[model samples]
Target: MKILPYHPSVLAQAQLVDLINYCQNTEAHLAIKMAEQADIFAIPQVYQQSGGNFWIAQDAQQIVGCIALLPLDAHTGVLKKFFTYPPYRGQPVRLGAQLFDQLLNFAQQHDFTRLVLDTPAAETRSHTFYEHHGFRRITPNELAVAYSYPDRHSWLYELQL
Candidate 1:
């Protein structure tokens, strides 16, 4: 797989729409959130000012994965939208590790010292992925303002870079 710079709105939407469709197949929530939209809109601004970077991964010619970096503070940041296609999920942790490494390298180059992210409370796969990369679980919080939805609360995670 090859990773390249990509604007989140370019292919991330299709991936997310695919996730929404997949969720629908399992009777899950399908509402889009402002947080996601804000992230999408901020990618360019972040890139311009050194606060964020977005990447796309491809297999052959298809976009199979994506990740984004967003600053949480001058010395800290957040990693968001890290995803890979379902068919490629069985690969070694290297994929996520590499993507995360890239983000961390960026943070290091920018003087960031920590990073934070949130994942769904029940997404065991994601929890494991984050844990394998040295993230620790923090107290779970109801992100009613960021998520703004009663049923889609998330557990927060953090990684020191």
Candidate 2:
């Protein structure tokens, strides 16, 4: 699969709608306690800002997965809204790893050194994904305003590039 930054006009309306639906389906059922972390609307807004660049995995010209990066500062960025379509979901962890690699490459080229992200405690798979990618979990009582979600405890991860 070819992964590249998202361009507003490159993705169709149907795909954006699907992404919204996917966001709702994925985060909607979290317990109220977990809902806060799941309710990050700025995820889509990142697409609008295009500040840190969003990446999509395309095959045969079809978008099968995507991830977005939002810079918190010149040296740190939050990786958010990552998803691979159901039909394309499976072990090819390479897909995500590669996207991350690209993100880091971009960061380095731009003089950044830290990549950060938050994952809900309930998502074991995501935890594993980050661990496998060489990210370390941070233990802190308070979270950054952007990382804090109401219902769930957010797990913070940091990768040094």
Candidate 3:
């Protein structure tokens, strides 16, 4: 598998949405309403053009994972849309971890002091992954008011870099 920076093109958005659907199908907790996900729908405006970036994990077969970093400010970047295709979701391939490491390396190089993300309370697997990566649970009140997550009522996490 290879992790590459996303390059805007006609099929880029479609590929991403397809990957999201693939993940959502198995992880019922991620019942994402595509229309309601504005940040993801407008990837270029929300991420690529706003001091942030998006990446995809592709193998010889297809895109197996995706991750994006949305800069909330000079010191912080919000990790977004992290999804791994079911077949490659865990060990052996470790696609999700590779995507995450790409995001982390980008964050550090960009001088981001912290990374933040929120997940639905039911997404225990994702929560554990983030926590294992040094993220600590934070109350909604602890997160800054400037950013709006799709799931405002979700559990929040922050990792100090």
Candidate 1: worst-modelled 10 consecutive residues by lDDT: 142-151
Tens digits of per-residue lDDT for model 2 on 1-161?
Answer: 78877665635434744654564466444433223433233444654364577777887777767776777776777776676665565565456666667777777887767777877777777889899888899765433435443336778788878
Ranking of all predicted structures according to TM-score, beginning with the best and ending with the worst: 3, 1, 2
Query: Please, what are the lDDT tens digits per residue for candidate 3 over residues 1-161?
Result: 78888876667678777888767654554666678777767777878999999898887747778999999899999998899877887878888888899999999999999999988887788998999899999987888748777663589999999
Candidate models: Cα lDDT each: 0.65, 0.65, 0.84
| After superposition, candidate 1 runs with Cα above 4 Å error | 7-38, 46-50, 92-94, 140-151
The CA lDDT at 141 in model 2 is 49
TM-score for all predictions? 0.73, 0.72, 0.91
Q: Find the candidate with the highest TM-score and give its number.
A: 3
**Which of 2 and 3 is ahead in lDDT?**
3
Task: Kindly indicate the candidate among 1 and 3 with the higher TM-score.
Answer: 3
Q: lDDT tens digits, residues 33-119, model 1?
A: 545455445666765356677776767767666677776557767777777656666556456666767777877898887777876
**Clashes per prediction?**
0, 7, 0
